[model samples]
Structure formats: structure tokens, C-alpha cells
Target: MAEHKTNAMRLLDKAGIRYRVWNYDPGDGNIHGTAVAAKIGKPPETVFKTLVAHQGASLFVYVIPVGSELDLKQAAKAAGAKKIEMLPVKDLLKHTGYIRGGCSPVGMKKLYPTYIDDSAMKLETILVSAGKIGLQVELEPASLAAQVSAKYAPLAKRGAGEAASN
Candidate 1:
């Protein structure tokens, strides 16, 4: 079968950005970021997940490595918001034009303030959802940052008892 083209991919193409697409079987259940990384033969550190948080009347986008969790305090600082909370899963599609597990920072319904974890700067390429659950796009971190106007900050933290995998 031919590879699927997502809105995110089309946007990247239109902008003259180069990327490689990877697809995996979603199987009989939901797939998390870590599993995605393994399926694509990439280290967990190189695969990032897009999360939307609501701060006051605004929504912000955060991209962090799948192996780490987003630090809400750090996210608030980066977003310059007094407080922020993850937007409800049910509202993701309405707010971001993508469903849960498939949200990509690019090609959202609107371009919210986007932030990428500073750790990504250390990697040559990173993988993000290609606007779908079974797909991902690999591209230079700097290129992705520039395309989305993302600010780099320390936005992730190792979960309790979770050894750093990246």
C-alpha cells in the first residue's frame, strides 16, 4: 500500500521541508510513544509527543520526548502563564484539529504558542506524529522548531523510579 499523506506532511512539503515517514501497526490496542519509538527503530529520546495545555484563555503546545513527562511547573514558566492544565482529551480534536494520540504540533486548527524540550537540540533528528496514530515524521530538530516557531526550554522530567532512557 502507498504511504498515507497527512496534513502535517503536506504542510511540511509545501514549506520545502524534507522528512521521512514511518508507519507501524497499531495492532489490537492503543500504542504509546515508547512503543512507537521501538517500532520505528528509534531511541525513545528521539520520539516526541505533542501535548496541549490550557492556560487561562489560551492553549499552548508542548513537544517533549516520549520517555519523559512534561513538568507542569516548567511548562507554565515556558508559556508565561500563571497556571496551565492539560486540555481534556475529548476536546483535543476540536482545539487542535487532531485526535488524541495523533496530534501533531504542525497543521493544528490554529497555531498556538509552541514549545519544544531543549533536549531535542542535542539530537540531529526527532520523530513526531504525522497527524495520525500509525504514522510519524522524522526531520531535523532545528527544521521542525523553525517551521513551528517553537521555543526550546527544559519542559520534561523523569518520572518517579523511571531511569533516564535517553
Candidate 2:
């Protein structure tokens, strides 16, 4: 079966960026980032998820490892906001033009300030949602960051009971 192109893919194509699409089975009903990473055969740390947050009138996008969670305080500091709150799931599509489990930092309805976890710098490439559930785009982290005009910052909070190794 031919793969369907998403807005994120089209945007990358137009910019002459190269990427590999990994399609996984979503029939299992598990669309969580870590599970998707396992299905795609990539380490959880290499598969990132896009999260959207807002502070009053401003919206921000964050890309962090699937195995980790976004630390709101760190995110606010990274984005220079007084405080950041996760954008309600109901309001996701209205603000980002993408739904949960498929939001890509790239090719959003608007290019909000984006921040990628600096941990991505340790990997040669990273995978992120391809604007659709069950699909991911793998590309160089720097390339992805440049495409989205994103800055690299410390934004991930390790899972509960996980120690900081760095």
C-alpha cells in the first residue's frame, strides 16, 4: 500500500528536506509515544512527541522524547513565559490545526515558538509525528529544528522514579 502524504511531509518536500516515513499498526489501539517507538523499532529516546501549551494569549510547541514528560516550569522558562499550561485537548485542533496523537511541530496552522529537548542532540536523527496517527517522520534533529525554527532546550522530565543520568 502506498503511504499517504501528510501536510508535514509536503512541507518537508517543498523545503528539500529528506526524511523516512515509518508506518506502524495502529489497530492495537495503543497510540502512545513509547508504544509507537517500540512498534517502529526505534529507541524511546529517539522518538519524540509534539506537545502544545499556552500562556494567556500565546501558544508554544514542544518536542520531547517519548519516554519523558514535559516539565511545565522548564517549558515556561524556555519559552520565556511566566507560566505554561497544557492546551486543553478539546482546543488542540482549533489552535494547532492538528489533533492529539498526530500533532507535528512542523507545518502547524501557525509557527508558534517551538522548543525541542536538547537530548535530541545526542541522537543522529529523531522521529516525530507525520501529522497523522500511526505514521512518523525520521530526519536529522538539526534539520527538523531548522525546519520548524525551533530552539533546543532542557524541557523533558524523566518518568516517575527515573533518575537523571546526566
Best candidate, TM-score? 2
Report how far residue 55 has shifted in candidate 1, in Å. Answer: 1.2
- Kindly list the per-residue Cα lDDT of model 1 for residues 33-110, writing each as its tens digit: 999999889999899999999976699999999988899999999999989999999989999999988899999988
Give me the runs in candidate 1 sitting further than 4 Å from their true place.
159-166
TM-score of each: 0.93, 0.93
User: Model 2: residues >4 Å from true position, as ranges?
Assistant: 28-30, 159-165
lDDT of 2 by residue, 1-166 (tens): 2267999999999999999999998875447999999898999999999999999989999999998889999999999999999999999999888989989998899999999998998899999999988889999999999999999988999666765444
Candidate 1 to truth, TM: 0.93
How does residue 21 of candidate 1 score in lDDT? 90
For residue 56, what is the lDDT in candidate 2? 95
List of clashing residue pairs for candidate 2: none
Q: lDDT value for candidate 1?
A: 0.90
